[model samples]
Target: MDASVRLHLLKSCISYATHDHVRKSGHRASMPPKALLLTSQPSLRNVVSRAWRAATSITPYQTSCFKPNKNWTLRSIDHGARPYSAKTKPTVSAVLKNIKDHTAENIVSIFHSRSNNPYHNLAIENYLLRNSHAQSKILLFYTNRPCVVIGRNQNPWLECNIAKIQEGLPWNAADWDDGVLDNDRHVIAEERDGYNVSLDLVRRRSGGGTVIHDVGNLNFSFIVPNDKDFTRDKHAELIVRALMAPMTVTRFRDHVLYDNVHVNQRHDIVMTCANVDGGNTQKEFKVSGSAFKLTRGRALHHGTILHSSPNINRQVFVAGDEGGQVAASVFSALLSSPAKPFLEAKGVGSVRSPVHNLFDVTDQVQRREVVRSLRKEIGQLFMDVNGMGDISVEEVGDEDCAVDMNGEIYRDAQELMTDDWRFCQTPTFEYRSEDAGGALKMRFQVKHGLIQNASLEHVELDAEQQLKFAGLEGKKLHEIQSWTSCLPPHAGFRHAKACAHLETVFPKIQPAGAAREGGAESTIIQEADLSGSNQDGIAVKRKAPGGRIELERGGENVVVER
Candidate 1:
């Protein structure tokens, strides 16, 4: 991303947000993913031309999602992020108006997400809010391919598994991943200079910690005007109530580590919560994390409900090893602690990430089928809450609602994807590594995604050598990982090794809090049998430096398993 290149892209990619006053047709070209968008935007002509030439000779990969049917019709059903020709289908407005005409008071809108691209999806979410009137509330059901999304104000480097994200960085496989699931994207990504996956770390315009979404996981968001209570706790409870799950609704507490992760068999989100008692509340863990964004008089309270775990979960580290220990402990505690509607099903896939990111009982295909069933249940729940005994479901192509005539959507998405928003918002913290595992001690200050000050220390380094690491003051962490080739040519081999190692471990962002100080101190429990490990009530705890720093936001804390 060069300055000029990013600018050119921003100027070229149209924003999907459109004004209702300017009514326009909602038809988009069939998504070969890259072909139509590239062809439409002049700047992408060269890239697409080169890509097509290269891709034409390189046989196309048929992605499972893109498996097209020759007999497909405009009325064909689209289950996941697939596209179909809809030229013959009725317009989105025509169908939406039909629903609106029949329904009254608390008019609810439902949409199925068809884009695996988080940027595109997030943009669409905003579009719903930005385009709709205050009279109606919107519910969007979406399943992402594989993407890590963080809150608006949080730091990406602090919240994400940056090391893994960096390893799969430059995902230029648009030509390969086109609506078709062959092994091409995997082959091209893996063999294209040693990257295994093409990844994007997205930031949402809401307040919450990190969340990872994949096809196995189904996400729903609600956008409503501010006519009633808009408190954060109520938002969390609303989701719990709607889903008809027994998981208690809670908030963050003082002296508690704000590991703002969703509490599940595998804790991966951060939130503040506690169970109510006689004027007292039991320590609460997070299952669903809700963040809010107030635009005009309306507020968008969107949250994630963990359904199935994805394989990437094993590689990500929220609080590194400690997060895992806490999740296992909480899950074990919940088994006998009288929490109703436990996700445990004896032999089905459990909700933890590290345990089984992949499907165990069935393949991803079957798992997705389960997700579809879950979506219907969610829809029924939505209707129940809104006092609607009956409601109609509309299935339309995302392109039907997506409008990118001017790339405003791209500009907004580009801003969200920048290094500044991702890492710069991280709270100032110090890192002191121990010699126990070839760790390096360091203190850092990053703002606007740029390193203002950084100092690293290794046992072998002298005072001068210690300061050598300070030469990287102005570099960004994302850029630092790729700087291996640019190490000082004149530096001694030993010095080069240290710098390289420094770069490798530099972004291992740890919590700065020392309160409660260790894993399982906040809560005690066992690794539940949910993950199919079949070992019931195994005590889960571990010791880590900085004691898995606990944070308190408003009132909730997210503790992870070690």
Candidate 2:
């Protein structure tokens, strides 16, 4: 045999003999696969021979415990199991008390949310998610209770008006320095342009440190517009259609990329109306042998609802019981309409908005339905902005105005709250070499007069200009650095491609790590599994250049596999 081959054979004989002795002495079942590798590879012959000599030379320690399988596999469960229990409901008083404690710090009033408890929160979130088939109530305004509002397809920071949010952005514009009508004061109305008006101010109600804010009573309404071409029934139809269609929730990104989306699911909502029909039923109740009565409407259950809203022109959103309460409260207070609960619990008192006729309603039927539906419990599914910075519907308690007065205000006052209002999109300012002194280009996203996002674009400056700009001081010119980020204070994020310039300014952000190190020698194995495909006693695989081992198990051969 060749000298190298002879050395490997000698090492293998020693390992086999030692392992046999261990098995006979009840210390182990078999030799480790690593021992076999050391015996087989010519490059490891010397090391293996030395190890064998040490094993033969060493005296045994009487108290030492032998671990039979040093390379044992660790297994774990994918999903944890939870015990099941009968579904329970939260008491109205407890829910109210929670909201009251949460929103207590705010000045002006109006609150809305799905629920507070994780169970109710999850249940309500799921319920609305499941029922987003209808284009129902989007402005889930509450008159006297409190709730949290998460953004739609927006990072809460990007969608929310931060300054106003921090300063207790009132749902009503009255509290805002902005000249627009307040959410709590003026009834949301539409303008001739058809776009819902929005205040320059950012209003937010954070979930943290949240407490209850008393919304006098609850009022709910599906603000469906009745234009000349759209009737109340048509508006209701649009809401139903929108609700029936599958609703979607998604993530916001500066650049669109798949997998950037974290959550995508249908809205959970349930519809029950004495007048609607057609849908599969999970359980049915009968009045008289053949006559059937509708009790509950669900997606997986029976109902005459479609999976998506039919209206392409209308926007749709649904409210849970808590949401419904808040909406009913708002509608009741603004419309002078009494608040009706989801099932019962009538709201006490006359309803009126601080501004009159806020809907900016031009159509008589919609105006009437908007007024009429204020009292009925038929369960509404309709479309309208409810004056989310749009047009005014009506005033609740305007001292000089009639109950139906339509006060126009935005064209005159929207900017009153501007400078302090934190904007969702911080305008990016770019300076060319000429605009800025030399070849250096500057880009930044500003918030509250602070540069939260910054970058410089480098270019070769003429010798004369470079000397002039360079005199201004400490700046690197040749280096081009860039990075992607999701900063605090705002949730909207920009993830730029990695660039050389950014590599210098931000070194640790680089993707290369031990994971990128070359060869298995540089790779660290914390654990491994040996089962099924790894039925073999041992398996060897080549590690990719980056130290990622792609193991292909050859079954039915070895006692254990690693």
Candidate 3:
């Protein structure tokens, strides 16, 4: 049988078993309780009510939210007489407290965000990582303001709109200093002070396409033992079910169903980010997405959820998107949904899917409620995972996580999120030059800190000029135009135009004196060096600058051999 069909059958079987268990119980009450009626399915509520009315005419049935017993089993009238107390409540910290060991492989804990600022939360994760053992598993959920987060290996100049930020602020022209950038997160704070602006730009150690963080959005990270967790369909399915839970669906009005949102099960791979689909194209609507980072033998899987709201709309549609088509379709889905506060879309292709925030689509739900529902679902999933059946779990309210606003963690996080580390550290990339002619568009590509390719749209290169241009391929971007000694006159203007575009993309860039043969030591390893014998190098030649250098320059031919 198909996996989807099997999962459906499993759900049906569980529902049937729950209904049977509820019906056979000998517990009796003066009125039919709310929890009992819901177990039979929403459509059968009328039949259940009529049967109750016929059997017991003394008192009317009173319904309330369902709560599982201490043993994690469904409750009947007898046990439903009283609700569970605060002791059984579950929060990320509280669930963790119940565990006897933190480093146990199966142990899972949910941690609430300490602050709305993205820096503090990540900093806390860093602090915890410093003290954690390899076997520990942790999950963090946060909601941040409008900001851009880059992948560990990405070129920030190409990934972010740095040119528009304060009219293309200039960064340090020389190569980034490792003594200053020394694996420290504090540089972000220094840049904030230097730039006289809040450090909103950030680069996470994980890999993924650029994403915009906004209000009405939830971010989740699962730090597990290995990459094996990414392949498990069960965990992904649970996350999806919680993301589009009944409560969230109800808030959006009946026009959209749980089917409106979907997930792609691929690790470290990103799908095209379009506006949330409203039942229109066959293109899968990726409402929730994730990226992974395997570090120190542990894996961190993180992603985002687009909850409904104006703040989300403003923050999610950053300048890089295809303008407002995506945002339009999303809001249209919400506004056009049916009166029932649920989603059900039959038509695909040209028939757009309904996508709306809960507030715009329905009158009954709130942001807090939707978050609560997700937390509850996740808590229950934990119980099932640990084989702790029928356990009591409540969505606890917020509390201070003991992180001082002016403390070390906060300061470190604040500094590590600055523009220098976020923008200047990006791998070299080309950009459009504003000073160039109206129709003169130029493009360039750089790799390993060297300009690999350069092009002038309508301009072609002659013999000597073409060879010079090709020779300039492996040179540093800033140094490409400065090689005036060897290049023929034709390559000068072309080189200058290319550099102009490069600086426009990377504002702070300046023409460094010469191209150093020994590359600077990288703070973050982009890719693991696996080219040696049996994936183990006899000697990793990739090392930081510590040796004396010898310069061999005979006329125009100059090389800084280290």
Candidate 4:
């Protein structure tokens, strides 16, 4: 028989078989039977099999009779011929089980996040804290892109220069026109260019002073049982030991470089050096800051290590010897708001201190070597404390794993990224602003991130202007994209200047529409659905800007326009 005629007969046979099976079982058939008839008649089976192969060779079969069923199972046909099975998503219980398995058998479990997303890394830390084995100790290492992370109870306005952070650090030619000079009056090789990376503002769950994280910095977290042995300074001391330990690198083999580094009263790691003239005078600069969180039965301690962050204010530097030039100050101080003197916040305030990078202490040390040294020293300490054998490090946060373990991690990350968590959680504060001559003064009382009261001090206004000013009472501090929008039309120059000052103090919050339309950071979270598969089968495609196609789903408003 001709090939086309054979394929037509095969199709007819498949349709009939599917209709018969559905009529008998009242459900869709997984696969039409080529076995039952083929076993009885071998010649007919061979002909049908040849026809099926010929049809599939041209293009995939897309017949109306072959509908997919969720409950379908793959089974072998005649002569041990098995059909392909589609990939299935991992269940929530299965993901949880995998985590439990990793922690249950191992006394010391180490994880290194491959994700640069701060929210995702933090969420993974939280997940490990809540779900890991109670008796097992967990260590996680992660690095975030350029971002300013404030404590849970801290105020963003007082801790950071919101305008600078939102706008990012742009290169200034004038500042770098002249080469950077060290204490010796010699030019240094430090890059004159400024960092142009996008900065994200985050409010973490742990309570501590605000800190900045970038690619050059490494964050280490410890999740251990909250027992009598657990102290806030334990992990910090371990970190200090790691810094003071001799490097594995050949050039620095016999040298213990960070001997001056020690943990301070506040659990922060600092480096203290004596004056070059052999005097008693000592200079100290913080190299790491620690933060802690205690749950019912578990305790979490996480801290940042400044390796070689280039985001530093070149104006500030520690004096070194005649041949030594040290760049130890971070640009965080420069990015902090100058309005701290005027704003009286209710939450915990950061203790201002001079910071230095580990690289400055020894130019021979690299970020990878720092991480390796820290990991080795910390792992040794953990093993000594727990009397455990050697342990291996596990990596997480890959695309497939992130999709599989998206239940709690996704929710926690989404919550942390929201404006409600970032800004609305701020404590009540009072902002006072005035001109240089004190002729114009404005005071705002903000509670729970909303403006509760507004009064223009030492200024007169009409009834309409007063009403317009009153309109600011219920407005949210973060939602206000522009301070001018809240002011009355043709407001006086003084009022405009005061509003402009307020605008500079407050960070710009991205609108909900912008988030839905795919804004920064949020876009990374929204593009991946909860189930990792489209719940709705309907898809709409449209041509977007830059000649890219945007894919939108019907049931879920997922806009994937990468």
Residue-wise lDDT of candidate 3 within 1-562, one digit each (tens)? 1234223323433344344336645743212222222222433444444554443331332222221222212222322222222434333443333333443533555555524555655665554443345666566666653345556666544444542322212122111111111111122111111232122456665666555454455677666667455443445565766545665456545434234444444421112323334445444444555666666777676776655334323221223234343333222221221111111112111222222332332211244445555655665665567555443432211121222222445445655555444534555545433345343344445544555455544458653354345456455543443333433344335755444434443444321111122123223211232122112112222222322111111211111111
Question: Among all windows of ten consecutive residues in candidate 1, which has the lowest summed lDDT?
Answer: 338-347
- Over 248-267, each residue of candidate 2 has an lDDT whose tens digit, in order, gives 11211211111111111111
- Candidate 1 regions exceeding 4 Å error are 1-106, 168-195, 231-287, 310-361, 393-406, 425-444, 454-474, 481-494, 506-562
lDDT of 2 at 80: 17
Q: Which window of ten consecutive residues has the lowest lDDT sum in model 3? A: 552-561
What are the runs in model 2 whose C-alpha is more than 4 Å off?
A: 1-202, 206-363, 378-419, 424-449, 459-562
Question: What is the C-alpha RMSD, rounded to one decimal, of candidate 1?
Answer: 20.1
Which parts of model 4 are misplaced by more than 4 Å? 1-97, 170-195, 247-257, 274-282, 313-330, 360-365, 398-404, 434-439, 458-468, 489-493, 511-562
Report, for all candidates in order, the number of backbone clashes: 52, 104, 31, 1
lDDT of 3 at 292: 68
Q: What TM-score would you give candidate 3 relative to the actual structure?
A: 0.46
Q: What is the lDDT of residue 379 in candidate 1?
A: 61
Could you arrange the candidates by TM-score from highest to lowest? 4, 1, 3, 2
- Native-referenced Cα lDDT, model 2: 0.23
Candidate 3 Cα misplacement greater than 4 A, ranges: 1-106, 163-199, 227-234, 244-260, 265-283, 309-365, 388-415, 428-435, 438-504, 507-562
Q: Best candidate per lDDT, number?
A: 4
